[model samples]
Target: MENSTVPETKKDVLKMVHKFKTTFQRLLSRENQNVIETDYEKCETNTDIEKKVFGTQKDWMNLFEDPSEDAKCNQFAKHIEDGLKEAREKHLKCEILIPCGLTMRIARDILIMSESEPCGVRGCSLIIHLQEKSNCTELVKLQYDPTTVSTFEIHLTLQEDTRHVVSVRKMMMQLTGCFKHSTYKSTPKMLCLAYKLEKQKLYRANC
Candidate 1:
């Protein structure tokens, strides 16, 4: 299969995860100007599993404070809440398209990447498919270029002066802001954000 094609099956998905891990690790060290410990144990274990066992391991140690000043989880939560409150007052609609099979994973990724304390995104990506029994047609798109490859684009639209568009833009900016600072030193806060995300997996499992 061509590398450009995204995998849909479990086996192919596992392959993609391995590939992404290699690329992401290289990017992490080079971009952050700091070395992120690789999950060598995972690499070994993953090799032992059957191709059908495509799911990844649950490692809580990964979510640690990098070197940032604030808690990434909190920052992400705030980002989501603030964006939604701003959009709600103006009645704007928002939508986000994350990687396939990576909805929660991407959310966790955002929490770590934001590296800000007390963040949430409930209202930011809420899609209004139907409003007052009417269909909405006015829409804008936001895309996050992860792996330096953009595949998903979220379309959002609003009908009134509710400043919905502005909110969407704000959320997108926050989510994508870290890429420009890839070369900066990792802060303690950044590591903590990563840690929280890994720990939260237990809580998220039931949801």
Candidate 2:
């Protein structure tokens, strides 16, 4: 009787271990499914927000190509406004690269400039002055002068080893400076401008 009871006890212990293992696996499978569902929901939410902010892909493409239409221009301006707001809220630094040529023309139109001037320059004198003030090995900083309207102050410093790229700081919501493209022969130069969007007024006001 004792020998028979020992075998029965061993069988009971084995059944208990198998039940626990199966239960743990089921819980793990449910947790994984929940994670996947949550990720899918987040992805759907982001897609909806993107669609709301920037219409369809074709609409955005057309807007970038030709911002001559007031409605399209307003949409682009709103996009920029959203970006600025998001950056501020997230405490992020934002930078915009305005390439030379057709894109630059579109930017000028969006900024409501009368003439198709590169870097939004009203005259050649300012471009010449900026080119003269710039150096190859130094980082140049340009900021709007408070004393004079549209006047900029230039600051230069030795290029550090870590500073491989040149960037304009403190020129928020305005054209900072124009620089020659380091690479790419087709595109000769590019403009650094951070725009502050003012909806319908963006077409009327100069930045």
- Winning model by TM-score: 1
The regions of model 1 sitting more than 4 angstroms off are 1-62, 65-70, 92-207
Candidate 2, residues 1-207, lDDT tens digits: the string is 789797456545544653464355445434421111112223333345334433444333333323354444454344434433443333322332321222222222333331232322221111001111243322122221223333211121111111113323222213433323322222122222211111111123255
Estimate TM-scores for all models: 0.23, 0.19
lDDT of 2 at 1: 78
What does candidate 1's lDDT look like per residue over 61-114, in tens digits?
122334231244444434434443444344433322221222233344443332
Indicate the TM-score of model 1: 0.23
Model 2 regions lying over 4 Å from their true place: 1-49, 64-110, 113-207
Tell me model 1's lDDT, rounded to 2 decimals: 0.31
Q: Which run of 10 residues does model 2 get worst, by summed lDDT?
A: 123-132
